[model samples]
Target chain A: MASVVGEEVSNKQVIFKDYFTGFPKESDMYLTTSTIKLKVPEGSNGVLLKNLYLSCDPVMRILMQRVVPKGFSNYTPGSPINGYGVAKVLDSGHPDFKAGDLVWGSARWEEYSLITATEGLRKITHSDVPLSYYTGLLGMPGMTAYAGFHEVCSPKKGEYVFVSAASGAVGQLVGQFAKLLGCYVVGSAGSKEKVDLLKNKFGFDDAFNYKEEHDLDAALKRYFPEGIDIYFENVGGETLDAVLLNMRDHGRIAVCGMISQYNLDQPEGVKNLMCLIYKRIHMTGFTVRDYYHLYPKFLDTVLPYIKEGKIAYVEDIAEGPESGPAALVGLFSGRNIGKQVVVIARE
Target chain B: MASVVGEEVSNKQVIFKDYFTGFPKESDMYLTTSTIKLKVPEGSNGVLLKNLYLSCDPVMRILMQRVVPKGFSNYTPGSPINGYGVAKVLDSGHPDFKAGDLVWGSARWEEYSLITATEGLRKITHSDVPLSYYTGLLGMPGMTAYAGFHEVCSPKKGEYVFVSAASGAVGQLVGQFAKLLGCYVVGSAGSKEKVDLLKNKFGFDDAFNYKEEHDLDAALKRYFPEGIDIYFENVGGETLDAVLLNMRDHGRIAVCGMISQYNLDQPEGVKNLMCLIYKRIHMTGFTVRDYYHLYPKFLDTVLPYIKEGKIAYVEDIAEGPESGPAALVGLFSGRNIGKQVVVIARE
Candidate 1:
């Protein structure tokens, strides 16, 4: 690879158009080509990255709304969206990185990105596994499942565990982790195929298609006759309310994301919070930012499972920059079967 | 003081009429006269009690409803209601009690009756403190505040603590406990008089009348500019919804009882639960039943505060057994200022 420093290259990018109410649609974003200098500027801790694989996550919709969390910088209307991705460093002024080092963390939805905030970026150490694992099972989502389940949920062996959005990025790993711990794990997902994946591929004790259930409370009761001891919450609103009613005494709910409420003008009211007190349930909300300090420890534990064929990962990849917008939109509609991803470039 | 254990006495009782929806009313229960032998049954673990003071609690309304918890028996339509009371034991079949023992725990809302469940009962140790305090500050409500705040909320020194229904038996004590622990304590009550008590009497840093606030969220923001660190959630529904919006990151909520939701046919949906995730909050629910094991520890801590004139206790006593129904009903409408106690006999 010859030095392409200061060379202007055509950067194909997925651009957020504007924040809109209701469920996100494909037209909310557009793909465009622009020129970018493939070099880090002088006297700056910045890394210029060639974005390889971009992730389509539920949080994308949360950032798309007019109301983002305090101090969180959402996507700028004209600029390319920032998300988790596997990138190859083309040039670097940061002491932590150099040219040809593979990394994963926060990156823009563009062919080439000048990443000023290099704090979130981690250098990819192991390459024996598929590089795409850095986008899902080994990245933010993996850390989320690890921290939320082991730390927040405080799961024990033989305890009954329930997971919502069970076939999605964070949910799949959580169910598997719970099962691997000798817990009786049950998961609820959108479609029949995803439910099948949860039961057959993920080794969950049972899994149900939430979309087909008329009575969520009854559905939960049927799966968890003894009541749920741990709940990994992703889908919120009705599912959360139903889960509350079925939680056993001293249950723990780890709130990762609420995909069901993200698109609504007004999120649904949770009526079953009274259950929190009656059951002495501890409902905790957390993010990967708080737990990333344990990344090294997380890798040490999860890698052996990956090597021994103990941990299974599923990814729904949409090839090319053109498919990015639709891939992101499909999350709200439950169109993606597993961890949704978009490939800007394979290598 | 001669034994009159075998004598039949007229037992004036407050009988629950029937289960009804919406807010409880005085008409829902009626005063009636019945007869009972003033002695424990032969070989049975029963305590014959002369009920002195009956507590008017919000949970009374809960038991009056048809939707009681599993294995929990609700108030029978024609039976004298069971509640917390300070009583003089006339006779005992259990080894824990003897004749002339002053005790507090579960008692029927009647002048003289036989109590079968003695597990919740405790022999009142200090006769110097008002026996009525056992029905309020020294008994269930006092234990409730102690456990919910110190144990459930996990309060740290200098943390911002907010108490809803701040002048009530539990809330007043919680606010005072937080202040005594070097925390910035604020409380919201239903009346201006109650608000005054929270500040001047209970030693809260500040107090507000929640009834006057048109926007509960703005009201909380005005009081807690830094945002609430621990919320003593007594009034649920809208107050809880507003508190959720104003909570600081990593806030803890201790749910003691949701007084606001108990009266409603349908509980208000808490819409701001998304805050639970955004702020990494821990919302926990608890009951006095599970925490009563720490009763001895609680009495040790709270008694010194009472002896030093440090923990101020205020009780609103309704004279005579006839006032029982009205005093209990007053809780829903915020008609009672402090701990509502109905006295059958002062001594």
Candidate 2:
């Protein structure tokens, strides 16, 4: 393709209208075409990039709301929304990055973005595998699962493990990692299709459709008869309470996320927390950002597994930046089967 | 005192009348006098002990209720209630103990008890300090504070620490321990008297009465202007939710007990748990039993501190075995200033 000199290039960007109050709607986001110069600005230590693929995560919805004392920074209205994405460098002024370098980290949801080389951003030198894998299976979600399980859960061989949202991005990797450690892995998903994937595809010991299981306590009892040694908690609420009742002595719960209670006016109460006293369970919550230093170690451990088919990954790609808003919001409704990613521009 | 031959002695026993529904009442525990021969059965390994002192803890209430599937054995109704106490051995068949030997461990709440030589029991050879210290300052609660802070919380010097129920048995030790580690310690109590004791007696950096503070979040903000690094959680519920908002990056919460919610039909919902996702806080629950290996090390570390007057301990001693029921129930009502103990037959 010939470069159009002196011509303003039109880039499609997703912008948040205002802070969200309740469940977000598609109308809350506006996809607008904006003009950007093809070159990096002079004296600016910034990298200009064309986004290839964007990750659609549940946390984006939390960033859209205004919470007291500010739980975290929210996306500014009228500004292009930002999250983790894989991009191709168009132009750069930083010494570490250059034009044509493939980088993956936090970036704006647009065809083009001007981002400073932040501490989190890293150049993707090895793309022997699919580049889109950086958005889910090989990137943030993968690191989340890896760090949460190995570092937080600290699973030993023969431990019984339970995972919630087991077919989703982080949960899928956690289930696989637990199985690799010789653990008896059981997972819960919203639908039978996802449940089947957990068992047949992901190689989990057992899978249950949480929607179909009327009695959560009974379901946990049936699945974890001896009791769960480790629980990778994604969906917290009654499931946590039920898991509490079935935790073995010295059990560990790695709280990655509480997706079920995120959007509720009032999160559900946990009635069996007193069980933590008797069972001496360790229920801990952690995030991927704090464990980013282990990313290199994580890649070294996981990349070989991916290449040799020792580890499997599944992605549900939504084409075009226009579908980004819907793709992100669809997470809450259980619409995405695996790691949800939006393909902005394929290599 | 001369041994009365062929004469049966009257043993005053505190018995559980039935399963308690909610908060236990004195009526629930019936004091009955029964005759015993004051002799150990032949070939039996049980030790017959005259109970000198009994420690009353909040966990006893949970034991009074019918057994739930919490993995541990619950106290049977119409049986003698048992917990940590300092005792004098009246007679013994166990090789490790003999008559007149001082022992501190789990024993029944009666004038006399026939206890088997269990693994948890230990003979108290060092009487350099008061024997009652075995029930509180040097025993289970002390070890709880040590393990929860050092092993679970992993405190660093100059880190900000918050202890709930600061004037109570475990909380006082936690606050003092955090201070001794060069951390800024703040605590919360139920009344003004307890708050004063926390600041004056326990050497806490700052203390507040949770009952007086209408807004717990505001109270936490007032104390922890930056953020809390470690939260020694004794009273959970709203206090936990408040602390969640004020927790710094990588903060740790050691969940010891949730006394505030013990009597509630439903546990309180925690809203700011999502903060864990953003801040990457590690909130973990632990019981001291799992860390018993550290007891000898704990004694080495704490005994010297006590002797040097670096650590101070307070106790509320009730006069007789008949007062044991009221003293145990008083824990729920915040009626005791410090560790509640009943003096049955002090050596």
Interface RMSD of each: 1.1, 2.7
TM-scores, one per candidate: 0.98, 0.96
**Over 4 Å off, model 1:** A1-6, B1-3
Which runs in model 2 stand beyond 4 Å of their true positions? Answer: A1-7, A68-71, A117-120, B1-7, B69-71, B118-120
True lDDT of residue A210, candidate 1: 89
Kindly list the per-residue Cα lDDT of model 2 for residues A47-99, writing each as its tens digit: 87888999988878778876632445788999888889998877788888888
Would you list the clashing residue pairs of candidate 1?
none
Residue-level lDDT of model 1, residues B1-347, one tens digit each, is 34388898888999999999998889999999989998787888988988899998888888998778653679999988888999998999988899889999998899987888788789998889999999999999999999999999999999999999999989999998999999999999988899889889999999999889999999999999999999999989999999999999999999888998987777889888889888999999898888898999999999999999999999999998899888999999998989999998877
**Over the stretch B1-347, how does candidate 2's per-residue lDDT look in tens digits?**
43342246888888888875677788888888888777787888888787888998877777776755464467877777888999888788888888888889898888877787555578886889989988988999999999999999999999999999888889999999999999999999999999989999989999999999999999999999999999999988889888988999889888898898777666776666667666777777788778889989999999999999999999999988889889988999999999998998767
